[model samples]
Target: MATAHTHVTKQQAPPHRAAELSAFGVLILLAGAFLPIMDFFITNVALPSIDTSLHASAASLQLVIAGYGVAYAALLVLGGRLGDSYGRRRLFLIALVGFVLASLACGLAPGVGVLIAARIVQGATAALLVPQVLATFHHALEGERKARALGLYGATSGIAAVVGQLVGGLLVGADIAGTSWRPIFLVNVPIGLVVLLVAARIVPGTRSEHPVGVDVPGTVLFAATLVTLLVPLTEGHSLGWPWWTWVLLALAVILGAVTYGVEKRAERRGEVPLLPPSLLRLPSMSRGLVMVLAFSIGFGAFMFVFALTVQDGLHADALHGGLAILPMALLFFAGSVVAPRLLSRFGRAAMSAGAVLQLAGLAWLVAVLLADWPHVYLWAMAAPMALAGAGQSVLFAGLFRSVLADVPAHLGGIGSGALITLQQSGLALGVATLGTVYIGLAPHGASHAFAAVEYVHMGIVALLAVGVAALPRFTRATPVTPVTES
Candidate 1:
């Protein structure tokens, strides 16, 4: 149950003045949404170059990846709460500025330690900035406009993952005056500066009227739980599954229980818990998260594992490795652009179709890879990749809308935060688990290992398809709207 403190606060201005977002404002928000996701995947192809340059061990390399991801995932809910309490525009600019600086630090770091430290800060700031984009859209847009805006957001997400790798490959190949992988992070500086300028001018400020109390104990316990779970998973293979790994995993379970207890207590006290347990009662939100976890696991595993397989197994150059995914990326963009229109007609059928297509693509890919093996080139992989990308585009384009269809506007920040938290967690866990599986098997043979993982991913896609089939279809009568604060 919502507390007495949860009522809407007085508006700073008239309602209409606060309600609308200009077109340029939407563009600026999309840019904000795009960069962080791109950065997440950009480093994939560059990891080998980084290891060579820094002489870093396998464990340290995993840290570089997991440190950014873990911090981002753990703090996302708190980040959302901060924006909800403060002004979203205010927090967004602050995080963006910090993101630019962190990128610079990551670019200039002399060693793995410094790079890892800088990346953690980078991810934390991303946690702060990303939710604001969606929350802002949820608040400012309505009806068809909202659907369109969300489709863009979904498209941007899929595009960034592919582009990150593409850009990483290009930057590494260009060597940008012999700086090599450093240029990938440094490239964000100018783009960020531009985004900050536009955002300051156009991004309207909005926050919940209700005063939100910081749930400190809940936040701490949540962070501890994620760290314990993610760290051990990410590092276990590199560290040879040390005794501490099992200890940390066990600790994660205890921390999770303690977190639940703390949240329940906060609810009894009529306080705003970090992630309101009550919100999970929303059936659409709950089911959508399940689909998010399943889809993201497949998506995340595909990107990380594909990069390694192409570059290491096939001995493809960084440019070639990045280009290999281009068909999927292009088709994904097309599918995302087309999905909003389809949703109006087919509703949840689009998602089911997407799932089917993705499964088909995976099956096709596995067969081709198995048949072609060492002889496979970018062209040979293009057909299945395009199909898979198109399918992914359709699935993600509608997922956010389906999830938030029932969420109230007042809880937009927390809702968006919750969605992204699950997404990042899925990504992290996918890498930790599937990545470990592939990495473990690589010593035997790279192609065979990659093919083995593809089969596993096929099963994951099939499971996600079943989940999509179960989602309630959207209808004209069930229009998507922002939930107003009580």
Candidate 2:
């Protein structure tokens, strides 16, 4: 009996287990992932409440959301580089802990100004937390096993977005034993503690042997270029067109060109760079990043607009808003779980289909909202919402793995960072552009604007499908590196 018990304990260890992850390892990491993704979306549903409680203006509110996303996007590459340089496991643990503390700061913030500041820090910590998940999965699981791990990760991410929106609604609506809207952020504490315990016990330590150091100059340039572009776009709605905004945007373009040239020079000189020149040269990575930029723009804006349409325009309240979004969230998760199987077989065809399905959903939405308007209910909207969710599941899963497939191991951190940065920044821009169009049309009133938003959605979705169809189909279906034994 003693011998059997000892063997059982040994079997449970990450390295001692299969080259594949055990259910426990995946579950623990999933829990760790939960808070970061949840925080991103949940805040959207809670935004109206926060605005009311803190007396924030529309610009302040936009900053509250933009602050987190921009900071997260800005730091992600460097954060990924830090993990690769020191150790992924070490950075992961540090980030998870920081996220918890930051969550506390966010929940306790007394005013709109303080809350926005706290949110920016929280987003930076989240960037540190998220990249490690991808790196760990890359280092820990093998072949189909690695694919499965990524699939689960993508599924969890999609689910979290939905969960954030829904749970945020529930918490704010319930007042949660009189805790009011604060519990949405405060809820991260206990979960973080449990995740820390599990991760310390289970997540394996991994790092690149010849890890490329952070490209300090490149990182600065990249961050500066993106920030100059994003800050104006995010504020464009409120600020209108300003000469300074255009000037900053032109500077961003010039800086982006300069960043690329510097990275190429560094690569030729045998120096480690933030985004290695060699990695950028990969046709797959280059094309993949472009698609990420465009896909994110549409998807990001839709979610923001959807929230406003349901709550502000329709006068539905938090609980109703959550319920309205539930179907999309559920269907998206279902699609993500199955997307790898489809991609493994069909490649770009699978992606195209996903976009088509999503477009169909948008078409349905355009028709329904135009016809139903103020009378639309949770049930009536479920079909289109579910289809949209399904579409996102496919898009997120395919892109997540596909983007990383061609990355050289040495440049993994910056490469991963660049991909995610494109994703984050692009999504922010999408919300800015699509959101601008949606709100620009809002003057025609909610129902008409809702119809117009779908036009933006359809155009974006079609454009993404065209982008995916242009890629090397199954070129990204396989693993870039063998998943290491935990």
Candidate 3:
């Protein structure tokens, strides 16, 4: 009996230890994922403070935001490839340290030029870290555990957007140490340090079993494509639609075509491309990427518009603006917590249901906006906001899962990078497009402009509902091929 008992204990030990480690590692990776996204939105609330403090020109201020986004989006695929070629753990740590140093530089910069430069560096480092989070989860976890982790990842993403605004407002409002907006960037220092120490101990070093070499030409072309495309959209309006903006837009189209052709040729030559065309050819990947783009566009647009409505239109302070959306943030978390269970029971249908719910919530909110107009109270918007948040949470997780469902494990890093790159691009596009619409119409009437935006959001969500509903119920996995490193 004693021998039998000892044998059982020995047999159980490894699995138990692994489970604990997996959970802790996920927490660390999620922390890494959270900071980059949070930093993106956190600065939104602090922008006014920054402008006042630095006496920044409008163009430089726009650069402060656009620069970070463009850098992050452009280099994401390269970051993923590096993690795959070298090691995810190594790259994650290196990127985390870079992110921390960049954050510090942003916080302490003596002038706006230095701040913009640091922000771009901060975004570039974030690209290096964030993709590893998803790739590691894909490579390491499986089945139910994978589902739950993905759900949590979706939750972390949604929550970070809201928390960024909330924390930024609070920090600016409190004026910690009389530093005003600086605390928003500086706070990342301690949190990042703690995560770094813990991650070193727990996060397993994982990389692609068949690593792909970095494709330099493809990388440069892709980066150029995104920079030309995103820069004009983000800055065109503020710069009063300069002739150069149109020229860059035209260049972006040509560059994008060239990049695709280069990547395809590389694949044909039996070289690993930065983004493999064959990977995008997978039905699950292509279709799910579209959904991700649409969802992100709506989300980004709504968040940007709502913040302006509360702060500029309603004349609320930063803290109050953040507070108005607290219900949405809380419910979003709750929905994410419940999403894995729903997916287990309902399969792909769960995503459709989530979209439907989101549409309903949007419709409700739009009605309230139309009815109350300028007189709308914060509490009046709470119910619909919460409903929409929960729906978005479910849809986000489901979409994330679907996108990678057919991707082979060996390609997880590049696949994850593609997923996030589209997501970030959608966000920037959303802000540029719908945000422009809102801003243009605001002078006519803030309430009317907001209502118009919400109507567009409903249309987007309604289409999303149809798209998710039409997705194939099952995904066939892509087969992996062994490649000898050249």
Candidate 4:
């Protein structure tokens, strides 16, 4: 009897040990997280260079941008599930390797078609990589450590947005190796390789306590639904809003309904679905997702539209265009850095305050645009941009923290995946819907088109602020903790 008891104790030991993460390890993980996000923003700045060099048509340029996004958004949940079922660290490494190879292909591609294909693959690889980062932080660290890590993650989002554009501008202008815009993709090779080498050693492995096989049927349906919805929205304006676009949109709705039904059935059958319906019912998660979606749409649209308006409309070069967004990025970093302390003091009110600041910034931008018209430059736009950035920083920091605060540890991968999927989808949708509006209005004038879209973005921020008011406040007393491995 004593021997059997000892054996049982041994069996429990591995599951009982709480994982701890080091600062260096967190940096490594954040670096991996930063890569894909940085790529997305960098590509925004590189678009014109790509267009001029590749001679890409309008529709093709849209594809270059939307292709990566569609693929990433569609498969993200599946990637998260794969990490949970197998090993988060393992999946992350595999995805990084794929990202490196795909980035190489993108840099070397001789034509628009190859570049688009490479970019789609690159996006798909990013899907596999992202959830693992959040899941690691969720499972490995506890208490203040977890909060600090999360704060840094939020800051990285804004920092990458700024750095990506800045780097893209510099790289394209430099034309290193006489390859215009190629360095943007190629540059990832060395950094990714270094991260890959160190990650295997530094990154901890974590998976769901109750691992399950891949839900093939659910993955297929989910992918189909996203593809159908995003494809038409992305390409429609460039394609003259074809009848097929509407058809695809309708099919997306049908597929989405079907996907839900299938997931519900899977839950009833005691089988794991891509996203558990019950998970969505969690008050913290659901409410946070709503706010996140709205905020992301505004952010995504603002970035894409603003870049085009400044560069194409105002005839600013890539460097100047990127510089124009610098103030926002800088202030965003500041807001993220102070967010933890702010949250501790003000709780969810911090997010609401962020929304108000963002609204003010948008109003300011409209005023500046009206006053300066075609004469506007980076210095002229600094104040409003900084205001908007600070607002976005606080809003994102709070929303990300609040959403995952109550997630069950075993569901970390799935929860992280769901949150990110919504965010990415929001980003894609913003680019599609708001981008289409801006393009349609472009004939009137760049300033007119930009002002109109800014209003739309402002409306989204206002709604997000109201949503923040309703979110449950997070306190230091209620720290995010991991569940038992069993």
Q: Model 3 off-target regions past 4 Å?
A: 1-22, 55-63, 137-151, 475-486
Can you give the lDDT of residue 88 in candidate 4? 83
Worst 10 residues of 1 by lDDT: 477-486
Which sections of candidate 1 miss by over 4 Å?
1-20, 138-147, 406-412, 476-486
Tens-digit lDDT track of model 3 for 1-486: 233123222322221112233787888889988999898788777766787899885456556766787788778877877886787778989999999999999999889999999999998999888877766776667776775676567778778987888888888888878897899899999999999999888887776654556789987998888788877876777679999999999999999999999988877766667777888888877898898899988887788778777766777777776777788888888887887678767867888889888888878887887788777788898998888988988888788767877766545545666787788877767766777777778779877888888888888888887888655564422211111110
How would you order the candidates by TM-score, starting with the best? 1, 4, 2, 3
| lDDT (10s digit) by residue, model 2, range 1-486 | 233123222323333222445668877877887788778778777777787788886667777767788888888877776776777778889998899898898888898888888888888898887877777777677677676776666677668878888898888888777655688899898889889988888888776544545678887888788778877776766778678888888998999999999877776666656666676668768888888887777777778788878888878788788888989988887786688788888887788889889999988877888788778776888999999889878877677667766665534445666776777887667666666676677767887876776787788789887788656657435442221111
What TM-score, computed on C-alpha atoms, does each candidate reach?
Answer: 0.92, 0.89, 0.87, 0.91
lDDT string for model 1 (230-257, tens) is: 8888789988999999999999999999
Residue pair clashes in candidate 1: 408-483, 409-483
Better of 1 and 3 by lDDT: 1
Q: Best candidate, TM-score-wise?
A: 1
lDDT of 3 at 54: 91
Q: What is the C-alpha lDDT of each candidate?
A: 0.79, 0.75, 0.77, 0.79
Off by over 4 Å in 2: 1-22, 141-145, 177-179, 404-414, 479-486
Mark the 10 consecutive residues where model 4 has the least summed lDDT. 477-486
The Cα RMSD in angstroms, rounded to one decimal, for candidate 4 relative to the true structure is 4.8
Error of 2 at 32 (Å): 1.5
**CA RMSD, predictions in order:** 2.9, 7.6, 8.0, 4.8
